[model samples]
Target: MIKACALLLLAFNCCAAEIEGLSAIGVGGIPMARQEAIQDALMQASLWNGAKVEASSSVENGRVSELQRVFPVQILDRYKLLREWREGSFYHVMIETDPKPDPVPAEKIAASAPAEVLATPVAAAAQGVLAKPVPVRECAQSDFAYRKKLLLAHFQLQNPADANDLSHFQDGLQQELSRMLSASDHYLPQRTVNEAAFNLQPGFYDPVLQPERVRELARRYGTQFVVGGVIRDIGAYGEQYGLAWGSDIRSGERKISASIPMLKLNGWMPAVAELGLKIKPSSRRFEADVYVFDGASGALLKQQRFADSATGDVIQGRDYIFGSRRFYETDFGKMVEQQLEQMVAGVDQALACQAFAARISRVDKDRIFIDAGSTARITKGDKLQLFRVSGSNQLVPAVNGDSSMSLGTPEALLSAVTITQVQPLFAIAILESGSIRPEVGDYVRFSMKESR
Candidate 1:
């Protein structure tokens, strides 16, 4: 797994001040909501100021132990808190920042404004998850023993010229993504059958994953995140005559690029385009959108498009079955594989800081059953923090505005649980601290990453 450094790279900044309005939950036991809102805004400001996220852990068996982040003092100093207000249980802050936006690699932060991301004390984000999470994690723990889950729902086609030839993309991409992620150390993937996977859709045109759709997916699949994609085009590149390949081959694969937008996270203002890959004249082109939805909130964490073109062996008709040896032998297969690699890399970065979560299936006496077990890599004797949310655990819009979103459910901590028995689909646990009753829909989460 790649350690994704979520550095906010600034572009050609004319030393212009930017306005960022961010929010967080102040309700319940969230500690400092006002500060969190301010910090959140600063994070964005730093991103635009070429800030990189990093982590340092000194706590071990012997020495005075702790996990911490060292922020870029200069970036923090540049942001001025314009104003702050509260609505219902949410705390909102509007900050004005001066940024010179540039996308610098995580390794290159030192030459510029060097600020490391400060991890919290309780390991609330995830165990040793150094990357900034793409989703909100108020009830998170840093536990390495468990890996976050991904459910590949469905891959769609955008009116293909050779629909049958590109048929493999509909489900093949899902299977292939599942295979790649399953082999990864950071994430576990839930395989989908056609009957269960076909119906799920992220959205069309500008996509927005609905909350209810996410809940249903979580209920049926028991996954932490749901991922889907739309194959926008796999055809010819406009009217330019191919330099080499047959007209039929060019017609099969779709057209894309020249001005392709990259990742477009919905909540944030302007869409982020890391690279605008261009397609060559008269070449077989492939382009698609990949989406990652949080099971907890159904919020679209990642929406990225990858475009690549090849001049040869782009399969026409159903010349070869997808993923078959013959298909892989073609240049088009290699192109698709390259995009899949990018897609998986994106998924890793999106989910890296997310905590491992399992739904409480049943509560009998002092024993608790969770939907994830050995199949999801559960081990006996593991301890997890338990919590009960006021409502369904999802991030929803705050009462008054859309500028900020809050975890709809104000989670109240319950007693910790010790895993005593493990199965493939379920695990049995008992309260480690108190003797109180928990509910079926409550959650059990690892606070930090732990050694396997």
Candidate 2:
């Protein structure tokens, strides 16, 4: 028995190699169970080697059932057949399988049937039908080395006072950039910290000095973009007055007298700037706006502003003065940090949008087809809704209802279509609804229900 099994295996391999486009056809008197088992085994084998199986169903009663199955196999210019016979069974079982050709050469699959036919064809007969396997390309790590370098530059943060403090910001930026790049599948070069230019001076609004300084720093650091902005105090004041008049009629002279002494006005100042303050208690606060720019071109890419009340005591003889203390300990510093975080988030969003646009352009669908044996991602026996835009002229009521209005109406309807074959670019489906027939270039959408 062992020797016979080995011989059978050898025979199977030889037969499989020699056969081209062998389709399994179950004749009369074959049990459904046996046929199904053979089909399943063939499908498994095809899928295991990246091949595809196309099967047709037997006709029942007087109606033709639109049922077909395709395996995960991909053929590349080769085909095979498998046949099994039971010594006692009356019918011989034959299976036909084909190797998918590369780049799936296109041929018209939906040819019209002959005028006279004994029964409806279960599947469309096309010349050289094949399924191509999805290709997986291995990308070399060196291809992304440039991206790693770019990412490194953006991840590093610099401040003048503490060279080592830049690392803290760098760590934060690295986490942010890492998450963004991972989600986007993008990479950039690693950025090294510029120890000489790590300065984040607050409340310093020297536009002339700052712009050149930032540009120079960016060039030295080998960065294409640099983001820098200033925080300032903007203040305003206003006043309102009320008038009172007193009239006196003395000695029937009808004399009226009005006197205006002084009217004091009061209003709230929106914001104030205070320097060097700890996080204490105060009613005054300020607003901070941070802007990011392209390092090379000095283009304003993004900006965000936040408002927070000062929380500390005021200095003597000064109006709304927040006393000098540790700058980092002050609420102003905290606000700056908050603004920085928001700026980073905005930059990340911009990067994501750029990546998404690039990815989407690669996969925009141009056309779709529905028929039995049409290649698609849909499974066998699944229903899809077919739709197309229809234009018609209709009479609608005018705005005043005095005159009739003729308008062109554009509408769409869903027709039930069942999937027969799912291929890479198109799906083969049968129209379930006799009333609606889908034409080429019509939209095709999937639906689970017969009517929707």
Candidate 3:
């Protein structure tokens, strides 16, 4: 059996042979074992039609060793997202691509989709294919070279539990989370974001205020996702095990136990007996809800609640900066650290499949420029796909509560280019294919599929 592979693992279990060519259908994305192994029969039939007829094979010891071809370019720049859907944890994206630039028809969208239309056919179709995808899917493995950009914004308190130390936790939240994701080596971290920059109050992402502001945040801060958090419960709550006998916890706490007088009369035996009458000790816990928003649209994408407990110094005050050495040394500090790990995982999972896109700042004859460079981990000779924004609009979920948002822009792939030169803030490239000349304000997207 022979398989056609892209630069990374684009094979997606799509194996091809001499007689059996690679199918236009690319089946990929593994969320769980049992369900992923069982591909949806309805989705399996999706196919791609391309203009290609090249397959080279090598045989070693009477066995086919390798099969190489360029049906789909080494970079997926030539591909187009055709369809996407999810069943349980399994999600699929069907795309059409070619060596030549192919244009998908523009779907008529106003400045924003009406909030009353839950799942507009146009919005449903544009889901991840055209708009920057949300609740993104991830590849099985991690990619180390490039780090996806993330902007950590404000976090709010659910209730004023007299935890004055947490009032300023927003700054600590930004600083610590920035440190956490940056340590993970999977995100380009920005932590100084505040409500002033986005022109909103705290928890704007909570109601999903002006969605266009996310695109502006992306443009100005160079981030793809905006994150916020809400502190729910961060106090001590008693545990009730009751020896697993289903005993009444309140009764246990109120049970009559031997006192010091009884201990003296019972010759020190009563004090020992009183220990069994005591209830379980209270444990300090930290509970918070993390909110993720698409930087392209202010739409809330994912909200995850995380809770963990520590044994000592779990509560913060006006003086404590979260994730500091003094704070981290305490039981509460460790619990917060653990929570940050999970938080980073959520952001990573949501963005792993979305392609990294950079805007074209200028386009000169035989020379094209993009706004990303070495800091983005892009190297020389890397190939990227060019696209022009046909137009854009705003999109909101239906009044009935559809959970999707759209940037409402249709794009046309222009050409593939190899990075010719690099700088700290920008990169230069020359077109390798296609006839549509690129202009300023166009976009170049990295073709590698694995953003983990």
Clashes of each: 29, 45, 4
lDDT (10s digit) by residue, model 2, range 260-339: 22221223421221111222123333443444443332334455554554433211111212222233344443443454
* Candidates in descending lDDT order: 1, 3, 2
TM-score, per-candidate, Cα-based? 0.59, 0.22, 0.55
TM-score between candidate 3 and the true structure: 0.55
lDDT, candidate 3, 1-452, per-residue tens: 54332221112223321111122221212222112222221112212212112333565567876544333212222333444555565444544332333222223221122222213344445432333323312232234446667778666656546244443565776788888888887777786545522332455534444556666666677676777777777766564333322233331133434445655578746445444343443467778887777665556677788987776344454455666777777676778788888888887766666667777888888899987888888878777777776533424445655433453346666666778999977899888753558887788776453221
Stretches of candidate 2 off by over 4 Å are 1-215, 234-281, 284-286, 310-337, 350-452
Off by over 4 Å in 3: 1-145, 160-162, 166-168, 196-206, 236-282, 317-319, 394-408, 433-435, 449-452
Ten contiguous residues with the weakest lDDT in model 2: 2-11
Off by over 4 Å in 1: 1-144, 193-204, 238-282, 317-319, 392-395, 398-408
Q: Order of all candidates by TM-score, from best down to worst?
A: 1, 3, 2
Task: Judging by TM-score, tell me the better candidate of 2 and 3.
Answer: 3
Question: Candidate 1's residue-wise lDDT over 286-347, tens digit each?
Answer: 88888777776656676788898886556545656676667767778888788888988888
Assess the local accuracy of residue 184 in candidate 3 as a C-alpha lDDT between 0 and 100: 82
